[model samples]
Target: MEYFGPNGDMYLATKKLKRIAIVLKPQESPAEFEIHFKRPDADEIMIKTEKDAELPHNAAIFHSAKTLVESVRVNDNPKKKRLVEDYTHINDQISTNETAIQDTLAYVNLTADIDKAGTTEHLNQIKELTVSINKEKRRRDSVLAAMIAHDWVGKREELDDLLQSDIQIQTPSTSHEQLMAMYDKLKQKGDQVAVLQSKLQNQLSWVSAEDTSRDDTFQELEKLADQLKDELDVLSVLENQRQSVCVGFLRSNKGVHKMLVELL
Candidate 1:
């Protein structure tokens, strides 16, 4: 169970000694904690940590520890609570990206011997993948920095809108080069429609192999790519110029136009 501290810090109820101990980890954040497990006294409460018990002066002395725990402060500290929530969101996104990177790493397909065949293309892909991951890490850090200090970005709303635009236009998963490479092959399939579709099926497996928790992998991008492939298949039957076919396909598919615009 969860409990709230007097200052809106969150605490998890845990067991330790005959008493209880709440560890203070996040100095800022939910502190972001606000957790305490302790034994009850008539007027005071005693809090403990994992290994060490507090002496007289070292203990946290709250006038009404009971009142603090019992009292509800849902609307009391909006700013701090919001900050805690945002911090959590940023961390979750970072975790999602880190997992995606690992999944992509498995698909890297590099051999121990550098001189192995097809190694150059795989190496280039790994290099590009590293650049993409680093770019995302920087973006994550910049978002956190903006949360803390917005002066560098001129206005907070502008930054917010910019990030919102990024989400709509360049979803985190869809922006990776590996997926882009797969899409490129589909877009420029030339006369080899069957070959392209078969190849894309294998590539789609790479995408489908990623954690389904990501919105774009199994749901959005895979669906979008399939739709685009169907369109391309029809165009290939018509034997239209590859360039015109790709461009025309984008213009006609209003649903995916915004997303495919970057590739064009």
Candidate 2:
């Protein structure tokens, strides 16, 4: 069983298109995660550039994608040219490794079947093929990790742009239907308070300092009435702002979608 991380699909892309590649540099000892992004869709031009070595391994992919976005934003032609060249070279290596891996796996499977049939003829070949498979898999993984990193970075930029946009946030409001519902509630509370007042008046003859419990109950009922009045006031203000606030919210929502599509 092969375990793929969040960036797993990147590795799988190798078999489909010549869009991925990598090169080993034991001497240079690059970061744990380095990725290159090409325009996956042909309508857009693929941009490439050198990755920042200072970026932390966990953030390498996203940061690289930011750099690409910046390049597009600023139209940095010289940097864009360098990145295009690098992208091509890396993809070439990925394509080569992908082919090599596919071929080795096929041979390995063939040899394994033959060995199972009690043929000692392909034993050495199987061992060599297994080693080759491991090597090719590592190379493929590196390439895919890079692609996944680019995806993260691109998405982050889009989100950031949306958040930073100057969309005046309007407070939410109660609709006419909502206000009508609340008005009904307020009316019910008012009726309850009126009933409580009438009961207190009827029981006034029984009131005394030794038993002020009935008076206290009437006071509590009065407070509840005041609370219902306050709620009604707030609902009235919200109802007034409902149309404008809702329109503002809709505009802001559309703006977010527009900004995100621009990133793509």
Candidate 3:
């Protein structure tokens, strides 16, 4: 008879009790046994035996093999535990990254509607959020590359799906036309203010030079200077208002541009 060891090594036994007992002896034996047994083929025969007869030798060999097998099983347990922990960590990271991306997209969408109503502070906030979004995208990409390298087949599919489903924010184009329009309006207001200022200065200079020589001329010049001063004040106010509008337009445009560049 032949039995397989835990390590897959095979040992032979004979029907003759002496040979069967001798072959099962432990390695540290002194005296040995030799027994003969009939072979499966009628014409053939063989003899085998172990060297030691200290105890039930076959039982000892069987138990030794069992111990080796058990040791291997024990060794694999920790490896399995580590694999589970690693998988859980990867899953959590992916979930967090996906949520961050979604939130960033939402913020981008909300900011898209900000036109004349968007304050400089609001635009600044959007810029900050976009910066965070880009950082998260980089992190997510790094995780995806790692997953691919590790052959994480299930995670690869899930990440691919998330990327595909992600909302892409388009970059806003530079508003050349809008800027030009605001510039034109401001230039016109500035020209009006300059004209009014010049007229006031000319009238005041006339009054100062003619005050002693001609009372009537000096009085007329004073009245003209006062009227010009009033027009200058009005024009200054209009210019300031136009400048404020221009500032708002520029700020909104900057925010839009920043959002676009991040998307690209």
Candidate 4:
């Protein structure tokens, strides 16, 4: 007699009346079976077999099914695990970059304040402050580059714009009085910028240290980006204010030059 096992493999047994049992495992008892046969033709017979086949058959079927099921489960889980690990690593990188950016911003703002205050002092102090501001600006640029590499598009753009405006403000011109006035306003702006930058740095440090998930880092970065944008707007206003003052000073100086020329 031939029978299909749970594994879908075929097994054959002799039709003798001797003991025939199917033992699935060495620790389990062999299930007994009663076989009835009726000769249908000269060379063919119909055989019906009975036993406690349901329990063993189900167990064998479950075992076979478990192999395939476990295999599929094992194959599927690793991709999810890898994805989770990748996400975690990316989050940690972002947090680290955010902290660096904030630190740079704080230093930039502090230097800007010093630039403003020092500009109101003697010529030597102003020159020293300019050098300090340039150094801080370069450091800030490096941080902006890192932020860009980390996919912080908005902040990178904002910092770039601020640096450009600072360069324009620092350009040499002959309107000492106008420069002084703009310098005063710049000092106030610098103080505000410094405070904001410091606050952002503190927040970023706190978030990086305490946050386990990337979501918090993302949120904090977004907030910092927005604040930076607003500060850039203020810088634009400062630029416009300085240009107006400088133009007025130039016009007055031109008038004085024309008066002297006519007098001569």
Candidate 5:
């Protein structure tokens, strides 16, 4: 399961398009959280620089869209880039060796807590990790009691000394080679993101050769419609007159087929 810390951050983009919000539970799919950032009466002037060069018509809207896409994408900032690399490395290690290092890591984390317990950040971590340490201690006592064929409480001090020694011996050795391997993966991911961003910016920057005039096109269409309506009206009247004249000729006394042709 994924989790978020209590910290919530947000940014405003003057040069951007649409924003949306989704459930704040699983996805960071844009939602409002409580404000940690109240505007103070400080003298620091924040000038806008993400604005694009003045372009014509729809280009301005496209520029805003470009800004929006870039703004939403993280890992572009140097600090965030480093943080992402560290997160990836940590998760990979934990997932791979979770079973193998459970007891040793528990012991190590407990000792680390002892050293860092003064800080508020470390204090929270220590509280949670202490549960793992207790579990390890209970497991150790059980196994030792079985092996010794007696109550583990009898030599509690000696048993703890031995356990500590074992945990120390099995401590993690994050060698240089392992670091380089992780770095290679991070580099590959960074390169892929760069390529994708380039493609997006290029696609968004496209402009038309000439400005289209919708008003002119609509006016022309209206003119043609009126002309067609007039022609249709004239055709309707002529057909009605022809029908009346044929009916009059049909009842002729002069055997009036020829008279009809020369009719008054």
Candidate 6:
């Protein structure tokens, strides 16, 4: 064996060995030792070493290539084995659940754009998918909760409650079909208002730019007034529809405010 100090400098002296005793030699300056077999037929090996040249306590000991082979009894505790197997199974299940959660989240993100521009049928599918995703998230949390409870005895109840809380998020009272129908109508009315406003602006520009007759000017003013009236009527209906959509969502869940604003 080669010796090393705490600073990792190698010592000049070295020794070669095969098998070593399980027990360490008792302390002695310039220590003398012998390696021997208990059997009468086996030979003994003698070792002489100086204490000053001892390796550091943390240094690793390596055996020679020709070391004697020995059999050792292994621990076979049934309870410990079962516990290890159970822990492995639980970890595998947790890994599977995590993968499922990742897949569900990916689907949710993928459908986000679709949710914005989807037809009523597609939107309905998205709504169902979201509901299913939430349920899967809850299930994942429950499994994690169970694992936490198994590991921590005193905080089981607290962890369980945190994971499986009774809080329920409300959904819009308006049915998907009704809400989409209203949205379509509101969009049509908004387009009409835009058209009327544009027409009124053109009429105003014409009246100001042209040197028209007084009767013609009066006729242009009347047409402007009619356009304004039509725009206002459409706007009033649009506002009512917007209010209905907003109230429908606000009454259900404040969390949906951003979504409603984006949709509008």
lDDT scores for all predictions? 0.40, 0.40, 0.41, 0.43, 0.39, 0.42
What's each prediction's TM-score? 0.22, 0.20, 0.24, 0.26, 0.21, 0.30
For TM-score, candidate 1 versus 3, the one ahead is 3
Model 4 residue runs over 4 Å out of place are: 1-182, 207-214, 255-264
How would you encode candidate 5's per-residue C-alpha lDDT over 218-264 as one tens digit per residue? 33333433443444455445434433332332232223323322322
**Could you tell me how far off, in angstroms, the CA of residue 53 lies in candidate 5 after the best superposition?**
23
Sorted by TM-score (best first), the order is: 6, 4, 3, 1, 5, 2
Report how far residue 97 has shifted in candidate 6, in Å. 23
Best by lDDT: 4
Task: Give, for candidate 1, the lowest lDDT window spanning 10 residues.
Answer: 57-66
RMSD of each: 26.9, 40.8, 42.7, 25.0, 43.2, 37.2
Estimate, for each residue in 1-264, the C-alpha lDDT of model 6 and write its tens digit.
534321233333223433222222346321322222231322432332433223321011111100100111112345433433443454455456556656656666688666655344554565666666566544433433332233335654553353345235443465324544554565566566556555555554443322323445545555655555666666677657644543454345433433333323
Tens digits of per-residue lDDT for model 3 on 1-264? 744221243454444442321233354222221222223332322223332322244334333333332332211235433433443454455456556656656665677666434544555665665676566544533432332223233454553343345425332343323433543554465465455445545544443331233445544544544554455466556545533433333244544323323333
Ranking by lDDT: 4, 6, 3, 1, 2, 5
lDDT of 1 by residue, 1-264 (tens): 444333454443433332223444434332233333233521333343422322221122221222222332222345534533454464556556667657655655445365455556655666666676666555544433333342223454553454456544433222223322433453344334444444445444454232333443334434444544565556544433323333332334443334332222
Cand. 4 TM to true fold: 0.26
Which window of ten consecutive residues has the lowest lDDT sum in model 4? 33-42
Clashes of each: 7, 5, 5, 0, 0, 1
Name the runs in model 1 displaced over 4 angstroms: 1-118, 146-264
Best by TM-score: 6
Q: Can you give the lDDT of residue 41 in candidate 5?
A: 31
lDDT, candidate 1, at 48: 37
